[model samples]
Target: MDAGCVTAAHRVSCHTMNADLFKPTPERGPHQSSGTAKNARNKPEQSKPELAQVVTDSRTGRSYSKGKLLGKGGFARCYEMTDLSSNKMYAVKVIPQSRVSKPHQREKITNEIELHRTLAHKHVVKFSHYFEDQENIYIFLELCSRKSLAHIWKARHTLTEPEVRYYLRQIISGLKYLHNRGILHRDLKLGNFFINENMDLRLGDFGLAAKLETVEQRKKTICGTPNYLAPEVLNRQGHGTESDVWSLGCVMYTLMCGSPPFETLDLKETYKCIKEVRYNLPSSLSPAAQKLISGILQKNPSDRLTLDQILNHEFFKGFTPDKLPPSSCVMVPELHPPSPAKKFFSKMAKSLFGKKKSKVEKIPCEEKEDRDISKLVSGIVKCSINRQISYKTVGPSEVTSPTGQLVSSVPLEPTPAEEESRKSISRSFKGTMASGTEPCEDVLTPAAVAETAMKVLKDCLTAMPAANRNPPCLSRPQSFLWVTKWVDYSNKYGFGYQLSNQNIGVLFNEGTHLSLCDQRQTVHYCLTNNKHFTFAANSLPEQLRSQKQIVELMANYMEQNLMEGGDLHCEEQASALPPLLLQWVKTDHALVMLFNNGTLQVNFYTDHTKIIVCKSSDDSYLLTYISRERVSYTYLLSMLKEMGCTSELRHRLGYVVQLLQHHTDA
Candidate 1:
C-alpha cells in the first residue's frame, strides 16, 4: 500500500506514528503534504472479516485454535490462542503479512521481536515463540487476562495513592531493566502496562522501542502517543531513557488525577504544553504525590528523577500492598495494613523471649519476671472458676447480679484494701449501669465475664426459633453500647471500632486490645483478657507510642470516612474505663467480638447490620439490633428467645453462635 492509500494492515506496520495519523489535512503537520494527508484520512482501513479459527506453524507443525479477541492496537490484534496438542494458552499477536510489505516496515517488526525475545524480567511481559505463514505473522506471548492499565483507568477514573505506588513500583522495575540493557521504550502509556491474572504488572507494547544511543547518534523521530511524548522527542532532540521517565510521570499523573497532564483539545496545544512542561497539579493530590510528579516531570531530561531515585521518593514510602486484588481493577480496594499495635507487641515479644523457646527458657527468673510482664498482661493463664460456685462464694451473702443489683449468695468479710479496690471498680462500672442499680460489691474477672457472656449468647441462640420472617421491632430505651463506626485494617494492624459512647477501640491482630476513652484523653490497653493498664493518653510509654499513633490514625479515618451504623446513642463517659475487647473472630460473613465486660457483638459484612448483647444496668439482658438503614431497636434477650426474631437477625445469630462455638473449641 502507498503512504496516501494506507490500509489498516499498513497502519499496523507504522504503529509508532502519533494518534493524529487519521486527522484531516488542516491538522496535519507542516512536513506532510495536504493531498497525501487527505487521501490517508479518506481511505477506510480494512481488516479480515474473521480471524482464522485454526492457525498452523509453518515449520514446527504445531496447530493453534484462536479463541476470543483480547485487544487491538495500531500494530496488531491480540487474541487468546491455545496450542491444540499441549492445550497451553497464549496471548497471540497477529499481524497480517500485507501490513509489513515494505522492507523498513518488515525490519521494524523484526527488531521488536528480537529485542523482546531477549528480555527476561519479572515485570516485563514474557515473550514466547513467533512464526510466520503466507497469511500473517503470529507472535505468542504470556496470557495477561486482566488486560491493561488503560481498562482499569477507564473503569476507575482514579486510583488511590497506595495503588499508584504499587503499579509504579513494578513499572519502574521493568523500565530499569530495559535501561540497564541500553534500551529506551520510547512509548510508555497506560495501554502498554499489562496486568496478569495475579494482578502483577507486565510492561508490554514495544512497538516504538529503540536501543539507547549517544546524544549525537540518537534518531530524532517524533514517535509515541501524543499525550505521553516528551518535549525533547517533539523538539527532535532524540529519544533517551529520560524520555521514558517523562512518560512515566505522565502515566502517574493520569492514574492519580484521571487524565494526562499535557492533554488538550488540539494536538498542537498538547505539544505546546509538553514543550513548556506545563500542567495543573490538583490540590486534591497528596503532598508526596505532588512532589514526586513535579520531580519527574522536569523540563530538562537530566533533572528528572532517576529510576532508583523515584523508587526511593516519599510517595513510595506509603502503604503499598504486597499484592492487589482483582476487584481493584474496577473499583476502590479495601486495603488494611497490619496494626501498629501488633507490630509493636511482636517486637517486644521478640526482644523479651528471643526467637527460640530454648532462649526463653534460658532467661533468668528475675529477668523473666521483670521483662515478661507482657505475659502476665496477655491473659493466657486463667484462674479456673466453677460457674456454679463463682456466684455462690463471695465476701457477702449478697452478690452483684448481671444487672449490677444485689443477689443472694454466700457471704464473707472483705479486707479494707479489698473493699477499697472493689469500691473503685464499682465506681468505674457506674457509667454503663442502668438507673437505680447498685454496683457489684466485687469485681468479675475477665475470664468469668467472657464465659458468662458466651453462655448467655449460646443459650439465647439455642432457644430462639428459626428466622422465617423479620423480627418484631420492640420499642425500649435507646441507650445501649454498640459499634457506631468501624474499619478493618486487619491485613496489617487490626479491626477498629468506635462505640456509641465515643470510645474508640482496636482489637489488634496480636490478640492485644487498645481503647481510647475519656473522650480520647485516656488510653486503656489490655494484653490479656483480665490484665490491663490505664494511662493518661499523653503519658503513654515510649514503647506504646506507635500503637497509639495507629489507633489514632484508624480513629481519624473512621471519623472522617465511615458513617454511623445506627442511631443508637450513649453519652460519652469522660472517666469510665472502656470495655476491653477480649477476643475477636472474623469469618467470611461477619466479625464477632467478645468484650471483657460481658458484651457480645457481631457486625455483618453483607449489610451494615449489627447485633449487640449486653447486660442492662437494671440486671436484665438487653439485645440491641442495628438495621441496615442505620436505625436501632433494643429488646430484652429473653423476649427475643420467647417471641423469636426475624430471619435476618436469626441467621446472623446462628452465625455468631457457630463462631463462638469454634472459638471455644479451639
Candidate 2:
C-alpha cells in the first residue's frame, strides 16, 4: 500500500492495518453463506442517533452546545462548541467511543491529549479542558477562525518573498519551542499551521507528536504526511528533531514553490526522491531562498539546518514585516513597517525647532502669484521645457506635439523668431517664480505637464544618433540632481526614490505622491497631481499620517538595503519647498520618473543603467548617466548634442523614448 493508505490506516486504528477503512462493508445477499449472515446479524449496528445538540460532560457535569462542524479526520470530527454556562467558544474534537474501542487505539487519544495540554506558547495552539461522555470524548482547543496555511496556499498558490519570510519566522519559532521542550512535531505541513483571526500562525495538530528519545530507543515509525516525511523515518532509523526540521523544509518549499518538493504520482517514488535529496529548485526563486531550501533539505538528517540556523539564514535577513494584515488570509497584503527614520527625524526636529514652534502651512486652491510660483517652481514645467529644447534638432516627422498629435514633416531647424519665443518662455517661467511679481496666467495643468514631458522624451530618443563603437570620455560637470537610490514595491505600496539632494519621494500606486524633504523634517503631499499640502513631520494631520508612515518605511528600507546608484552628489540646498514628482511610467525594461524641478530620470532594469536629464541653475541643460558599474558622469546637454555619447547611453535613451511613446499610445 502507498503512504496515503498507510497514513489513513494509522489514523483510523493507531497504526493497525485496517483494509476496511478503504472500502465499505459488504451487504449479505441471498446467495451469501448462512454463517456470514449470522456473523453480520450478531455485530453491533453501525447506525446511531445524530450526536446530541447539547452534550453534558459526565465528569464535570458541564453542558455544551455544539455549533457547526469545523473539520474532520479519520478518528474524530471537530466542531465549534460553546460552554452553555459561560458562553465561551472552543474548537471541540469529538472522537466516538466506537472508533477507539481497542485499548491501543484509546491509548493514542490519551497520549495526544496529555502531550498537547501541557504545551503553552504564543505560536502553539492553546489547549483548553477536555471531558468525556458515554458516546464521545471532547477535547477543546483554541479556535482558529482563518483556518490553516493549507487554505491560504490553496487561495494563493505561492507567496511573495517577504511574506514567506514573515511566515517562516513564526513557524521556526514554534518549532524551536517544541525542540527545546524535548518534543517533536512529526507531522509538519501547511495543513497543521493554523492561522488565527489576528493573522498569527499557531502550530497545531499534535496527534502524531512524541517526546524526544535517544537514537537507540526512538520509535522507528514511518508516520507523517507522505510528501513531508524525512528519509530517516522512511528508512526506519528513528524520528528526531532533525526529522521535524526536514518536514519544515518541505512545508517551506510547498508554500514558496506551490507544491511539495518530493511529491510524486507514486508514494514509493516520493520516498526514493527524498532519500536521494533530489528536487529541482526553480530559477524564479531568489538565490537566498534557494540556498536556505537546499540547506534544510540535505539528505543526511544531521546535515539539515537547525531551526535557529534556518531563522538566521540569509533569506530572513531581507524585509520581513513584523505582522501580516488579516486580509492576507485571502489576498495579498499592503504591509508597511513602522518607520524607524521617522522617530529619529522627529527627535532631531524637536531639538532644532521647539515642538510648539513648528508650523504647518496648507496651500489653498487660489494663492498669490509669488506663493503659487513657489509651488510651480517645485512642480513640472521646468523639466518639460528643458527636455523640449534639448532634442529640438529631431525632425518634425519624428516628433510628437504636446497635444499628442503627429507633427508634419518639414524643415525642423528653428527660425530666429521661434528660437526667441522659446527662450522668452523659459526666461519668463523662471523669472516669475524667482521674482514672485509676474502674474502668469499660462500655467500648465497636470495633464499638460504629462503630455509635454512625453513629447520631449520622444523627441530626444528620435533625434539621438546611433550608438558609437566606443564609450565617450569627456570632462563632465561637478554636480547635478539625479536619483541615487530607488525601490519598486509597486506590487503593494508604491515606487520610492531618493534624490542626490537627500530628498525622498514615493509615487504611490493610487496616483498620489508623498515626499520627505528638509533633512526629513518636512513632508509634502500632492493629490490628483495638482493639489498640494505641506506639514510638519512630527505633527501631520490624522488623514495623512498613514501615508507619511509608508514613505518613512520606504525611506528606511532604501537607506539600509540599497546602495547608492551613482557617486554624483548634490548637497542639500535651502529651499522653501522641494520638487514633487509630476508623473511616472513603468515599463518591462525600465522605470521613468519626471519631476517638477526639471529633472527626468530613467532607470533600466537589465543592467542597472540610468539616464537623467535636467536643467542647471545656469539656464543650461545637463544630462547625467550612471553606467552598469555604478560610475556617474554628468555633461551639459549642449555638449552631448555636439560631442555625441557612446552606444550604451544612446541605446538607453532611445528605450526611454520608446517606453514614453508606448505609454502615450496605451
Candidate 3:
C-alpha cells in the first residue's frame, strides 16, 4: 500500500511540472486525486487580471489605455501615453519615488515647477501640468517636434549666418524678456538652444533661473555652463545679467569662429583661459562684430552693454527681424532645480578663480608703481598733429626741401595783396567780451575776465599770419581743429560711441560750455584740472532715468578710458585731435554727446579712405579699414565703383582726394 502511494505521488509530480511549464490544469492521478485537490486548494488560486492592472491618472480624471516608454534622464522617465478621455497623445515625464523622496530633491523639483508655471516667453519651452502618483511624479510638457542644437550641429556640421543669426536673435529676445522681468536664466549654452521642425530656435530647460527683488540682486548665484561661463561668475564676487550676455557672446563667437572663444581639450585649461580673458578673434570679423564682442566681454558687469545696447549693434543689422516677433511664440520652460551638475561646476569655478589669501598688506598710493601718466599725456598733447619731420613731394612748385630752401629760380616773398590782407586780418577781432548782462552762472571776476580776454587776443593775433594768407600758400586757417568719431559700442540699441580718433558725421549745431551749479546752490570756482562738468538744468519737473544719466556715465567712462591709457597705441602713428565741435543730442530717452575733432575722422570718415567690409569669412578682410563715423561716406562707398562721385560732384567738393578718387573712380 505504501509503494502504491509513492508511485501515485511520483505521477502527480510529473503532471505538476508539465502544467507549470505550459498551462496550469487539473490532471487525473491513479490513487492521489484527493491529495492533489487538497494541495491545489492550500496553495491558492491564480491572481485576477484586475489585481495586476497598472494604475492610471484617475485623479486628473485622465486615463491612458496604451502607454509606452519614451526616454529617461537623471530626473525623470518620459513615456508616450495616450489620453483615453480626449483620444489625444501626450508625453509624460514620470519621476520615481526614489528620485524625489528626499527633501532636497523635492524642493528642487517644486522650485522648477514654480518657475516654469509663471515664467513665460517665446523662445522657452512650455510646461503644462504637474502631479504625483502612487510611486512616481508626473510632469506633462508640450511635445517639441524639433532637434537639439547639438543634433543640428552634428547634422549640418556647422551653421550658416542666417541660421546662426536667427537663433541668436531668438535667444537674446528671450533673455531680454527674462531680464526685464527681473529673472536670470543661470544656465545658458548651445545645448540649451533647440531648433524646431520649422527651423525656429527655442531656449529650453530653464531649471536654473534665479529671481531677484532688484536688478542688482539678480546675480547672487554662481551657476552656468562651464564653457560659456563668464570670468566674474567664476570669481563669485557677484554676477548679474552680464553673465548671460557673456554666454551669448560665447555662442556668437562659436558661430563665427567654429568654436567657443576659450576652448581647450582640458576643462581646467579652458576655464583658466576664460579667467585670463584672452581671445584671438578671427581677423576677418567686421568692426561691428568686434565692437559687440568687446562690449559684451567687459570684465565690469555695469560697464558691460545691456540687452538694449546689444540689439542696436551694427553686426545685428542684417539679421534684425523686419517685424517684431511676438513674445508668446516661444516655449516657457520649467525651472530646473539645483543638481549635481550645477554643484560640480559652481565648486570648480569657485576654486579656480576665488580670491586667494594674502599675507601682505596692499601697497599705499605713495608706494605704488609710479607710471608718470602725466608724461604720457604730454606726449599725446605734443604729438596731436601731423608734424612729420620728413617731407615728400606735396604739390608741383610748392617744394620745401629739408634745407628750408626754394629750389626754384624765384625768391618767394609776400605780394602787396598778401601784405594788405595780413594788415587787415591783424586788426580783425577785438577778442574782448561784448558788453552784456553778466549772468550769475557765467559770472567772471574783473581781473580773470581781463586775463581771458588778453589770452583770446593773443591767440587771434598769433593766428593772423595764417588766416590772412592767400590760397596756394602753406599757411591756412589754423583753427584749433580736431575731429571726434562715433562708434557703436553696443549695437542691440542705437547707442553711438564718441571716439576722438575717428570721424562722426556732420552736426547741425555745436554746443557751447555753460556754468553748472551743484546742489548747494553755491557759486563754485572753475576747476578744469579734474575735467568735472556740472549740469545746471534749465528745466526739470522729474528725476533722471538711468539712460539719461548715461550721459554723465559715458563722460566718466571716457575719462576712465583716457586715464587708463586707452587703446590708441595702434593708431599712435597717425595725427591725434580733439573735438572742434561738441553736440548735446537727445532722442527720446537716449542722449549722445558728439565731439568732432580727430585725425582718424578726417582720414576714415570725411575723406572716405577706409573700406569697411560689412561681412567677412576670414580675417584678411577685417584688416581693410579703420573705424570712422561718416554716414555719407558709407552711402557713397556702396555706389562709388558704379556712379563715379568725382565726375558727378567734380566742382562741388573739389577733387575727392587722389587715393580715394582712384578707389571710387574704379
Which candidate achieves the best TM-score against the true structure? 1
Summed over model 1, clashes come to 17
Kindly list the per-residue Cα lDDT of model 3 for residues 1-666, writing each as its tens digit: 001000000001111111123232322111111211113234443332211012366566554422344443344545544443343445566667666778987887788788877866777766777677667677766554443555444444345444556677788888888888877776676656766545567776655676744545444455566667788777765557788888888877776666678877776796788888778877777777788888887767778888888878776765433222222123221223357688799898789989755568776643331222211110110000111011111121222322243221111243454334324322321221121112233333222322332333233223333222112311221122122333222212122233333322221111111111232121111111111122224331122122233433444454455321122212321222222222222211112122221111122222223322221222111111222223222222223222333211221111112212111111
Q: Estimate, for each residue in 36-140, the C-alpha lDDT of model 1 and write its tens digit.
A: 111323455566545565678868777775655676655467877766445467899888888889999799889989999999999999999999988889999
lDDT of 1: 0.69
Residue 631 lDDT (model 3): 24
Q: TM-scores of all models? A: 0.48, 0.46, 0.38
Write down the lDDT of every candidate, Cα atoms only.
0.69, 0.66, 0.41
- Ranking by TM-score, best first? 1, 2, 3
lDDT string, candidate 2, 1-666, tens digits: 000000000000111012222232323211111121113234554553456656787666676656556665556677776664454678888889988899998999999999999999999999998988789888999988777888788778789888988888888889889999999988887877889877899999888899999999999877777778788998899899999999888888887888889878776797799888899999999999999999999889889888888888989878898788877877888877557798688888889887565457766634433433332110112222111111122222233423243322222355564445334444434421121111133443323333555565555555555545323533656455678888766557666788889889886655456789888888776543133455578865444667788898999999999988877777667554566565554443456676665567877666677878776668676667777778877776655655566645555555555444332322
* Model 3 clash number: 31
